[model samples]
Target: MSHIRLLVPLLITAGILIGGNGLQGTFISLRASQEGFSTSLIGLVGAGYNVGFAIGCIYVSRMLRAIGHIRTFSAMAAIAAASSLAMLLVIEPTFWFFMRLLAGLCFACLFATVESWLNASVTNANRARTLSLYRLVDLGSVTAAQYLIPGVGIGGFQLFAIISMALTLSLVPISLADRSSPAAPEAIRFNVRKLWNISPLATVGCIVVGLTNASFRSLGPIYGQEIGLSVTEIASFMSAGIIGGVVLQYPLGLYSDKLDRRVIILVATLGATLAALYLAIFAGGDEWRNLAGIFVFGAFAMPLYSLCSAHANDHAGDGEHALVSAGMLFFWSIGAIIGPLFASVMLDLFGPGALFTYTAVVMVAFMGYTGLRMSARPGVPTAARHGRFRSLLRTSAFFNKLAGDGKNGDQR
Candidate 1:
């Protein structure tokens, strides 16, 4: 019953978040197509959201510390709602960029607060189940939100207004939820150069994961549209990949924990390479095949970073998790910035197939490096040997980051 109560607020929050983000998979591409925006420009707009999101992550912790989580979350949602609604009035790409920036900032704070709250509420005993449930709600909400796109014409700004309203309403539950005082805000002190020195492989892994994931997020819709998938089908294709990631992450993480983390990463990269190759070579103009390939790619590629993060944590003490997380996010942002540019260039040079080719090559390189590392350190276990996958799930800072203390927050 208590879990049921907890889930009520979580579901509401997920609704708001999914409403805001899920449509992007189709909305951005559709909007660009309607406006006749250049492919490169569209890519820039998509990348801009990531840049804004990264910035928000970097700064939102301090904002919450100063004002408390409830106020911070409410303000963020309000801002995001306003910005989203504002999109209806302003159709200019440059104007939309600023709006996306606002949305990104607000979304970051909202997610961070909610995730922290979820983390604080969870105990070690039930963390994995709780986190898994949280992720399920998140994935389900987003997938469902995708279905909303077909009802509202992509050109109508009314859809965005509705999304904004959802975000506004999401603030109510968190604002009124009964909870204890929030934790003291942790300071983020990132030393990227120092991180690189400490774990070069982990650092590189962060970059690769960021690049691959961001490209998938920003450009996948465009690719879908290019291949002649309808908006609804495109949504399903993108959602399927995310669903696969949510399902596969823990199992893969558990397996990585038992062996050298690098080997798991290598295997994942290889799998991603194969999936990408299949998509590039054989899935041409076939929607179902492309979707399947994407799902497989996501299963292998999306979780590799979490595994790398766990591996990095294994080498650090408890105090260093925040630092590592921050560093990883930062590197991920850098990669996110580069990923779109490279993907765009490839799209221009070789068409939609270039997306898969570019990603596959990167994975191949990472796999090669991991193999070399294994050769040098043949038998060392990079992570603990335990089937504590369920237990470890509860320990995730990612969930905490999402449900920090906000009404509608979930982070990855």
Candidate 2:
């Protein structure tokens, strides 16, 4: 009860920020297509955001250490809100690209601040429950915010204003709350080779997910728009995928804990590959068919990160989970930085269907890689597994700590 009360302000702040972000991401893609921006240009804008995000993850902890969490969050939130409105004022693709970069940096810092604070507040006993509540807020806010696109209509400046308003309002909760800020997190260090050696399958899994899932999130709305989906249906299309993501998280998570984690990873990649193939080859412009195919794709796709993270942790040494988690995210960001541009070019050269076709190809490659790794190495013994399965969001490194044993965090 005490924890819930203490967490209310942070949760409220997270919900507001996530809602605005979710709406902004989909809205930007749709708006860029509406403005007749080239598919390549739209993809470049998306890549710019991921690049900024990677940079933020590298430096934001230093800012948190120097200034403290409240000041850091407040500063980033203000900048993010301004950036949202900036895009409204300047509709040029070049301007949007830099603005999105700024927005991504701000959001990364904001989430890092909030998540570090949340980790500071919880004890080991209640950590899992606290994380579950946080995930619920994340899922609800992101899914509900998708509807704002159709509700507000996408062609004008109103949606941007609303996004700015939501971001600005996010500040109210953290600023007004009486809670003290947590201690600063360690600076992110990307020892990529070390991580790959620890768990090759997990490293590759994060990369594959970043390639496929990030591309879909950034460009799927463009796909719908090109195929003649109404604004409402586009919103539904995105929402169905997000909602379907929740359906399989726990189920697959439970199974992964018992079986060889690689087996589960292979199964998931196979499912996502087949679903993407269906969308690319069979779904066409039929609303229900596309919705169903995307739903299945999301179901198998979204949980890969958590699965990968768990697998990596299974192999991490003592006091190394936090480091491994941060490394995995860094790899994911690398793929995200490149995926949208590649997928967008495919869309331009081929058609709307090429978006999913691109994802199918990536997933198929990942599935084959998973099989090869399985043949080369053995799974972690069940008794030696470090932690139970916990669903994850690719928000910040601190997020993984909330589900960890708490020792690694203390060691840091």
Candidate 3:
């Protein structure tokens, strides 16, 4: 009970920070459109964030080790808040891009700091409950934050101020709390070759999700605006996707545990590809059709990461779970950095519809790749499979530990 009490401040801080960041992401896309930024330029701006995120994932642990979680969170939160405000002040494309880059770095570190603390504080007995609560906070905060764009009217300094305030306020609970800080997280080192050897399918799956999901989130608002949806509708569109993601996690997880995970991944990829194709070709400007299409897309697409993680861990030997998680994330980051830039170019050349057209193409490619891999390799037998399915948030490597990665040989 006392340990859980210590986690309250961290969860509160995560909710505030994640909500602020989520709103800012969607708003940035909408605002960039209002400013008449080209699709290509906006894509570059979006990619900038991932680049900084990738860098932070690798280096922030060093800072954490030296200064510890509280100080690291404090410094990063201050910088993130400043960067949020800076974006409001400077309307130039170049300036906004740099600010987003800085924001990404700060957010990666911030999430890492909080997740490490949570990881350290929980016992294996209660880890699943704690992780579930944390995930609930993460999903609820992000989903609710989408509505704020329409609520605040996304136009002036006011919305930006709100975002900055939320980020800055995130610092207060942790700083004021009387709890001790956790041990600093170890620095992440990538051995891409080893990860590939463990499970090529999971490695590729992470990259594929990074490409398709990141593109959709970064540019989906623009897609809504281009298709004539109002701000309220756009909010619903985004939230529907997130909610749909939650809907399928447990069901798919149960099946993945019984059957081969590859089969699940293949089916999910096919579903996502079909949904994207439907959105690209038939959904058109209709609101309900777009909403339904995106909902199905999210349902099938979102769980692929978790399935992949489970599949990889099945093959990973003892002591390899953390390495697998970190490596997969690093690969995903690489895909994220490249995904937006390519998708943006497609959106520019083709149309708003090209957004999903881009995703559909990518999904189709992955589906084919999954087929080839399935042909080559046999899955771990059901009894031999190590872990159960857990829904994941791509916040940080330490977050994976909260799922209790190797103990009892359960899947993280």
Candidate 4:
């Protein structure tokens, strides 16, 4: 097959995955609302997804090691499809929680498969560009999905079915394509205590990032409701935050790469704190103003995890990168699980605005801690480059070889 032909299937697969994932952000809360779920129940639904995602991350690599990428990817997609369709028949909060959990598990598998594929396929010269393209597809698809809510309506279970179909459809290209499987990491068990010992700042950064992100994802809709925004408006508002994250990541990442990563993290934490404070205190009842605050908040807050991931990788040895990534994932998941419950209680007690208030307080503490850490133990100078995107492109061959190796032998 021509290389150009190969690109078509890969890009299509990316589109399907991105679009399918994007739908949940806009639809999940609204769907729960239509079924008369309470705020706490809705929070549980969101938490279920993250908990499942964390579980998937822990085990899916082993599954891939056992079955290879294509089979595992296909099976996961099928499971996700079944789970999505099942939601139509089961409307209870408990049932929906299980469904969301299943969906999250499938999502983690699909994401792992696709990201590994992308990582393996690109040559060093285009690694960054390919990753950037993948991210762009994700952001664009998510933005488009936000606009899809009004047409589908909150009552339509068919939307979930449609998302399931998209996930299922994602397997077709990979199943038939000529690309090799990507190399999965060896089963290096991640220990949170060990990770903290390696880079305490990075460890803390992941936890904070996870807490902020999960809270925002799960409760943003409820907050929107309390503030009296319409469903469509809420979709737009959430989309704005996502868009902010997508648009700002490159520049911010580049800027961070130029100096001490801890310094960059500290600045981002402080900036996010200010943004959250602005939203919590001055947002008032103006919908547009509130949306703007969300955008700013996302611009600073959402990228923290990625920055932390990169920083952790920076301090880790080559063999430890995957372990560090896994550790970060673990901490992030823990944060995700705890964030919604805490944020929800705060909202219930102090009002919806307390969500942002909680975020701001967390950010302030994170910033303060980062400053103290940096002052206490300044580490070796990081790569003085502008962005990882360029480096990624140059290493595409490494990824391609890694993918080819995974096809022929067990990564684990």
Candidate 5:
């Protein structure tokens, strides 16, 4: 019961952070259109955020080590809050690109601080449950943010103000808390070859998930607009995917543990591919139908990351969990950096439907690759594996730290 008390502040902090984080992608994509930016150009603006986020992960470890958690969190929160408002001050895609980049940068550091604080706060006994609650808080807040968008009306400054407000509110909880400082976060080492050797499929899966997920989140609003959906409908469409993820992630994960993990990966990628194709071909003019299809997309697409991550960790030695998890994220960032730009180009050259078309193609390619890998190697006999599935949250740098001192395990 007392542990719950400790977590409440951090959970509230997480919710507020995710709320702002959720709204930023959709708000910026929608607003860019209002400012008359081209589809490809808007995509670049969105892509800039991922690039900045990667930089934050890559570079901010040293800064966090120097400055400490509370100060870093507060600093990033202020910068993020200011960045939200700064969007209201300008209309250029290039300016907005930098602003989104700034938001991403702040969030990366902010996520690192939140995650480190959470890891530090927990004793080994309650770490698993606490982390579980944190993941639920994350998904719920992000899902809520989608619905919250309609209330603010995306065409004007109101939405930006709301994003700024959420980020501001996030600052209060952590700043006022009486928690002790955590030890400095570990310096992450990114070795690409080591990751590929651990599990080629996992490394590749992270990158492809990055490509598909980021494109959908960053450019999804534009796709919604391109189709016949209203702002309210667009919110619903985005939320549907998140809802699907929350519902299906655990059930499917439990079932996956019973079989070769690659089998589950194959099935998930196939479902994702089909969902993307459905959205591309059949989802026009009908919001509910679109919602249903997107729900399936989320169910399959979102869990693929966790599945792949779990698969990789199953084969890794205990000490290497952190390195493997962090490296997987490193690849994910590479894919995310490139995903929006690529998806956006498809939108420009083909149509808005090209958004999903691109995702579907990628899924198909991944599916074939996974099939090849499965044939070549035997599944780790279920008894030999030590790690379990952990849902990966893009909100934090805690991927390596999530499982708690390497006892419970790491990310999705």
Candidate 6:
């Protein structure tokens, strides 16, 4: 009860923040397509956003170090709100690209601020609960926000105004709340060589999941529009993956906790490969099958990062989980930065269906890598496991930083 009272403002802040971000992501893809932006150009815009987001993840840590959380959050939130409205001011692809880049930078900072606040407040005992509640806010808001697309009307300025309003009003909670904020987090470190030594499989796995997930997120709506779905249905199409991530995260997490996570990773990659194949070739014209395929693909793909984190922690030296988590996100961001362009070119050459082809190919490569790694090294002993498999939001570096902070234990 005390915890709820203390964190309610921050939780509300996070929910509203993610809601606006969710709306903007789908809104841009839908609107860009409607404006006749080339599929490649739209993908570039999305890639530009990821580029800004990646920079923000590293930059926000330093910015917070210099300025503290409240000022950073307030300023970033304001910038994000203004950036949302800026999209409405100009309709060109280049302009939208710049707007999304700015939004990404702002969201990256907001997430870091919110997460650092949560981490500083929760004890090791309550870390899981705090993180779970945070995840609930994240998944719920992002999923529901997608439904705003049809009602707001993709062609009009209404959705942009609404997103900006949400961002602006969200600031009120933080400003009015009387609770104390968390201390600033120390600078997070990332050493690629050390990360690879800890768990090469995790390093490879993060990149693959990033590539597959980023491509779908940035370009999935255009795929839906190409296949003749209305804007509302496209919203559902995007939401289905989030639903899959929510429903499947824990059960698979429980299973992975008890087994060689490499085995679990292999199983997940194979599952994603099959699902992507189904999406690419067999799910034609049937919304149910396409949605089901995406849901299953998400179910399999979303948890691998968590699984990889758990796997890496099992092999990491004591007190290195934070460092490794930061490194893993860096690897993931690299994949994300490159993924949209790669997928967009595929879409350009092969059509909307090729999006799944991109995923399928990557999952196959991932499966091969995991298979080789499993053959080369024995599994981390379950008894010796040093970390739990917690479902992480892939949106920002904040969660990755949090994942490293608490005592490691089996989550399920």
Worst 10 residues of 3 by lDDT: 403-412
The TM-scores, one per candidate, come to 0.89, 0.97, 0.97, 0.89, 0.95, 0.95
For candidate 1, give the lDDT. Answer: 0.70
List candidate 6 segments past 4 Å from native: 400-412
- The residue-by-residue lDDT of candidate 6 on 1-412, one tens digit each, is 6876788888898999988888888888888888889999989999888878878877888889889888998899899889888878888888888888888888888887888787777776666677778888888899999998987789888888999999998888888999676677778766778888898888888888779898889999998988888888889989998788677778888888898888888888888899889999998767888889889988888888888877887888876776776677778877887899899989989998899998999999888888899899999788878756777776565675455445441221
CA RMSD per model (angstroms): 4.1, 1.6, 1.5, 4.4, 1.8, 2.0
lDDT of 1 at 187: 62
- lDDT scores of the candidates, listed in order: 0.70, 0.89, 0.87, 0.73, 0.83, 0.83
lDDT of 5 at 411: 33
- Candidate 6 TM-score over all chains jointly: 0.95
What is the RMSD of candidate 1? 4.1
**Model 3 ranges off by over 4 Å:** 405-412
Candidate 2, residue 194: Cα displacement in angstroms equals: 1.0
What 10-residue stretch in candidate 5 is worst by lDDT?
Answer: 403-412
Model 4, runs deviating above 4 Å: 1-5, 178-185, 383-412
Query: Candidate 1 residues 1-412, lDDT tens each?
Result: 4754664675567556755666754576567767877667676776777677788778877887788877887788888888877867877878877787777667767777776666556654555566566666667777777777766767767677678778888877765666654774666777777777656777888789877877887788777778888877877888888776766777777777677777778888888899989987898878899889999988888887777766665554435656766676667777877887678778767888888888999888888877776676543353332112221211123442432222222111
**Which residue pairs in candidate 2 collide?**
none
lDDT of 2 by residue, 123-172 (tens): 87777678888989998999899999988898889998999999989989
TM-score of 2: 0.97
